[model samples]
Target: MIADSEIELHASRLMVMQAAWKHERGEDIRHESSICKVFVAEAVNRIIDRAVQMCGALGVSADTPLEHFYREARAFRIYDGPSEVHRMVIARDVLRSGNRS
Candidate 1:
């Protein structure tokens, strides 16, 4: 699970980098940014959840920062446009472009 989460994190980072590159070139990155927001938000939540699970009860305790991290990660999914909304944006863009790939 940890290995899978690491791969997901790396993939999310690459997506953000690609979006940043497009932005640097003065191209509109609305679609790319939406993808990044949804992916990275989920990736972070998954990674943090794994950490909390590994730490067992201590992970939820106030003695560590895991709880705080988990809470923030959960909020990340909702604040920057919910994942469902972003997914709809992505789907609409793809359908409008007629690009299945």
Candidate 2:
């Protein structure tokens, strides 16, 4: 049983994958999609951070993929509406739903 932190990271990746599938199928996942985007973006950064830690000095070096991943993950949040904005939207939806259970 691999109980590494990456397992949670994979759950984030799966959220994105499910969102993509829903989009491809023309399903309306707007509010939920924003939540997934926020989750995945944050998760990618966490996963990359763990990778960098595991690789030690090589992680930050230009010669390793860890460096590339770290660099790219920084832009993911910005390109797709940013996590803050998405979280706000999610919160708005929850409040609007009025199903506070």
Candidate 3:
């Protein structure tokens, strides 16, 4: 599970980097960046949640490092523009694109 989560995290980072590279080249990638950040944050949150749950009550208790991990997992949803905001951005982008075709 750890290995799989690590792979997912890495993939998300790669996607964000790729989108940034395209933006640097003058591509209209505002939506891409938003989507990438949302996905990456959500993925990392899921991984951290799993790690915490696997540790049992220690996950939320202040006696263990899992508590800190749990805090970070909960924060990820709000730190990067929030999941709902990103979803809205993606939907708007898709709708605008469709109208142009």
Candidate 4:
């Protein structure tokens, strides 16, 4: 889980960078932005969940900020737009572009 989370974190960072690059080039980045948002939100939640699992009960205790972080991370999925909605946006874009194999 930890390894997967780390890999996803790097991938998500790259996705954001690519989206930002597109935006800088005066390209419409709505699709890329939605993809980045969804990917990063899910990645953050997964990473925080793994941290909580690894720490066991201590993860939720006030002794650590894991619980607080977990709640905030979860809220990320709903901020701006929910993951499901962003997913719909991505799917619509892909289908409209006929980008599937």
Can you write out model 3's per-residue Cα lDDT over 1-101, one digit (the tens) per residue?
78878888899989988898988999888778787878888898888777777778877788887778767677777876888998898888889888521
Ranking according to lDDT, highest score first:
1, 4, 2, 3
Rank ordering of all candidates by TM-score, starting from the highest? 1, 4, 2, 3
Stretches of candidate 4 exceeding 4 Å from the true structure: none
Q: What is the C-alpha local distance difference test score of each model?
A: 0.92, 0.81, 0.81, 0.91
| Best model number under lDDT | 1
Instruction: Report the lDDT of model 3 for residue 90.
Output: 88
Model 1 worst lDDT run, 10 consecutive residues = 92-101
Against the true structure, what is each candidate's TM-score?
0.94, 0.81, 0.78, 0.93
Where is the poorest 10-residue window by lDDT in model 4? Answer: 92-101
Measured on C-alpha atoms, candidate 3 has an lDDT of 0.81
What's the CA RMSD of model 2 in angstroms? 2.8
TM-score of 4: 0.93
> What are the runs in model 2 whose C-alpha is more than 4 Å off?
17-26
Model 1 alpha-carbon miss at residue 34, Å: 0.5
Error (Å) of candidate 1 at residue 63 is 1.8
Candidate 4 or 2, higher lDDT = 4
Candidate 2, after superposition: displacement of residue 15 in Å? 2.2
